[model samples]
Target: MKKILRVFAALAPLLLAACAPTQLVRNKGDAAALAQQAAREQKLANANHWVLEGKLGVSNGQDAGSGGFTWTQDGNHYEFVFRTPITGKSYRLTGSPDGAELDGADGGPQRGPDAEALMRRALHWEVPLDELRAWVLGLRAQGADAELSFGNDRLPSMLQQDGWTVTYPLWDTTRQPPLPAKVFAEKPPYKVKLAIQSWTMQ
Candidate 1:
């Protein structure tokens, strides 16, 4: 009886140890998957919102004021409409990344320094706009490569990616419920500033 008991006790520990790794792996995998899912949710939440309307202002060597601005991105094409309160004139601009074509809304021929610059300045907000899009809409941009973080509210800082950067504020958070409190591009001089007073996230 004693010998049989010892054999069973020894076998029990070996079985338990064998399962420890599997359980550990399973638990770890579940946790990792959850984190990824959360990141994805946040990304889509940021992008699915079809429109962003708020104020606009620029200060370069003492040029600044309040203006109305609307930004929208759909599929591969994006547009920005900036309205100056002082002038009450809004400029509507759009761009597309159709290979070398660089399509624009004005029915003009695409491709050139101007088109490239406009595209860069528009839809491709180097900040987590893509991630926001991903989080908000659950639509991942194929091989999109970006690292991200979050705050209890919209973050205020510069987002640097692939030699590019954009600065913006949390104008409004959602087609539903999330928004950037403030954001910035990694530019120079006023790269890290947030224009909060001139914004209404509706």
Candidate 2:
């Protein structure tokens, strides 16, 4: 009985911690400092190349799908791959300022002007690929106006950019340049969510 009581007591704090809200902002006054910190983080992200592996879910009002996702970004170039387990099929999309291309195992590469547009046509997923270049790095897309909301940890909790709203619920602090682990972004008629399992930076 005493041993059981002791065990319960020892686990109480952890249980509470797990239940506590992660997005609570205890110090609203820290917004400025947080913004500055975020800017520094963004700079680091933009000046370097990175890769992310994750699970992705997309919904477009009338349809929904999920798959394994991988993205590699270097300077102005990027390659995004998605594999759907059920169909045993993979899709690859590569893009740069020059243009975008989509290829599959059964078909030749198709070129398009924009990655997002290519995705909509090829995969029917309305992902905001251009804005995601910045959003994936926890920053608003360059040259676009945005509104940001910060959490207690002085990181972005939510961001409203262009026509989308992005939320950051978890950050992977273990990495050299901490990255977002779970990101959800949505706009009317389209929604996408990513749970990043790995991050590699160069």
Candidate 3:
């Protein structure tokens, strides 16, 4: 009985250790940095009214197009105009919470309840304008969970959310909150790139 008790006692600690819950150890510096990043993101999210002048490029593994664009946003309303240099043609997408409209396509003006659907139907482009609104301001989109990696400057270098990977290659640090100079997003077989030239914040 004594020998059996000794063996049982020796195995008890090993059993307990195996059943113990694992705890993740997070560094204090990393936690603080993440908190600061969250605060910055919140600030940018509040900036709903702004204008961005940039170049946009898109590819769908088969077809590709590039153009200069001006995006103006005021709360829930937005107007995006893209001008192709080669063809000297322009396309405009204007929308509010009520509805969305796409003009200057092959046929005529197309209206839909959603911007993404309208663009896809008229231009056959799979641009995610809803998420891009948040992303253009260096903020993450709502709804889905996102994974972020930071650059040496402590700004977001890359963000992964909603099946898309968006990268910020350059930042305009001269601005108060700092804006993205270049934003590139990809989901295999589809790619969208934006290069911002100027910003007008209202």
Candidate 4:
């Protein structure tokens, strides 16, 4: 008995340390709940018409593109339009909830992933895009989950809820029928910044 007690005493510090609490690692359940809450908030914020404007910056390089956008959601269909620095072309794309190809600037069909996909591919950074658009439009994602948090900015900020830290900068205007300003996802590995300026509801 004395021998056993001595052995336990010698190991107590290691046992206590193994059970230490940590705040950095986010729980999956909690993260999902946060996403659901954010979806609810976003859907409520969605309207027929809203305006937005902001810049997108990258880490490895620098990119600033700002333009006006219009999204019309009818049933499960969505129509989007935008004008930016990357393309002088004003693209109007309409597609269904599922993977459907629409008018694309490259003379190709805009499909799964969509413009954001191309942007992510170009920037070489992985981001929660589907969630981003939903969040930007203030709607819930059709398939993927999301994360939302309030940030201190000239507008509102929503940090990632996916256990990954992707800080999104936003500005919520106090318009009867609330509206979202620019929603940005600033990533690391060269400092990536993607912004959706001016989102107007048709």
lDDT of each: 0.38, 0.72, 0.76, 0.43
Task: Compose the digit string of candidate 2's lDDT tens values, residues 1-202.
Answer: 1232232233333332442335445333375757665665656755548788987777676566666789998889888998765555678999889999998733467789888887777666689888887788777777789887777667677888988988887888775456778788889888777878888887
Model 3: residue 143 alpha-carbon error in angstroms:
0.3
Please name the candidate that would achieve the greatest lDDT relative to the true structure. 3
| Candidate 3 Cα outliers beyond 4 Å, as residue runs | 1-29
Ranking of candidates on TM-score, top first: 3, 2, 4, 1
Candidate 4 at 143: error in angstroms?
Answer: 6.5
What lDDT does candidate 2 reach at residue 187?
Answer: 99
Residue-wise C-alpha lDDT for candidate 3, range 11-109, written one tens digit per residue: 333332332323322232256557767878877767889999977776556555666799999899999998766556788999998999988886788
> RMSD, each candidate, Å?
23.5, 11.3, 19.9, 17.5
Best by TM-score: 3
Tally clashing residue pairs in candidate 3.
0
The per-candidate count of clashes, in order, stands at 25, 0, 0, 25
Best-first order by lDDT? 3, 2, 4, 1
Q: lDDT, candidate 1, residue 111? A: 51
| Selected candidate, larger lDDT, 2 vs 3 | 3
Q: After TM-score superposition, what is the CA distance of residue 86 in candidate 1 from its true location, in Å?
A: 1.1
